[model samples]
Target: MEFFSQSLAEALSMILSMDQKLYAIIWLSLYVSFFATLFAAILGVPAGFGLAVASFKGKRAVITLVNTLLALPTVVIGLFAYAFLSRSGSLGFLGWLYTPKAIIIGQVILILPWVISLTLTAVSRIDLRYRRTALTLGATAFFASLAVLREARFGILAAVIAAFGRAIAEIGIAMMLGGNIKGFTRTMTTAMALEHNKGEFVLAVALGLVLLLVSLGMNILLQLAQGRYGERV
Candidate 1:
């Protein structure tokens, strides 16, 4: 009890003092997660929209595969990414191994399926008649697609939030692909793990506390956005 209290007090001090190293870790975590989510959204949403709207052979198989991949473990992704990014691998020429970019790549792969599946759900729920209505009004197929996307915007936002949350909190990708390099690729989760391994209890606790706060704050913001969106709609 006494030890926990002491650790908590030190954590408060670290936060209040604006510990540069701590902030740097936090910033890198957010940076990688944000860009990863962005890239994933770009790739995933369109695929999802296509899955929702287009018809083709093996469509059910593809959808089932995507839904299954949504539950793929971060560690498995890390291993596969590492294998591909290593010097002997096909993508090795890009030389992304053990770097922030590597972690970003892993994160993008990790979240994309979930984004796609969620997006498919969102777009699928919209009545197909809307597309017919728009096309009947002389709108291009592109414009009709846009109408569906706009209506499904909130669901897409939710998907992004969920992806971002997962990316930020995940330790496996950061540790394995980023190599947890200090001041360069280290993230909150990796830092916490490193501190714990090194027996730096106070700093580990601090990082954990901050990670929790970050996750909580993001969720609160999401709820507020949903509220505002609801009112507007």
Candidate 2:
């Protein structure tokens, strides 16, 4: 009991004193998560929107595949990325292994299914009338789709927030792809794991606190988005 209390106190002190290394880990975590979410959103949003509005064969199969990928383990993604980025692997010439870029790639693959699946659900929930009304008013197909997208904006935002949360909290990809390099690719989750393994509780506890706070913030944003959408409805 006494040990835990002392460790907690030291962790709080480190956080309050704004330790550079601690902040560096937090920053790298956010940076990688932000870019991964960005790329995933850019690609997933269009694909999801198409799935919601378009009529095509095998659509159910594609959606089922995406849903299945949403449950893919972080370690599996890390290993998959490692296979392509390792020195003897096919795309290894770019030398991205054990770097921030490598971590970002792994994280992107980890959360892409979340973005796409959530986006499809969001767009699917919108009434068909939204699109029909826009098209009936002589709007072009592109503009009509935009109208529906505008209506589903809040739900899509929630999806993005959720994806960022997933990317930030994952440890496997960062550890395997980034190699947990201090002051470089090290992230909050990876740093916490390393610190814990080294029998250092202060830094690990501090990073855990920061990770919880980030998660809380994401949940708050999601609730706000859902609330705003509810108000409109």
Q: Which one wins on lDDT? A: 2
For model 1, name the residue pairs that clash: none
lDDT by residue for model 1 over 29-129, one digit each (tens)?
Answer: 98999999999999999999999999999999999999999889999999999999999989999989988899999999999998899889878877778
lDDT of the candidates, in the order given: 0.89, 0.91
Deviation (Å) of 185 in candidate 2: 1.3
Q: For model 2, name the residue pairs that clash.
A: none
Determine which window of 10 residues in candidate 1 has minimal summed lDDT. Answer: 224-233
Question: How many steric overlaps are in each model, in order?
Answer: 0, 0
Q: Each prediction's TM-score against the native?
A: 0.95, 0.97
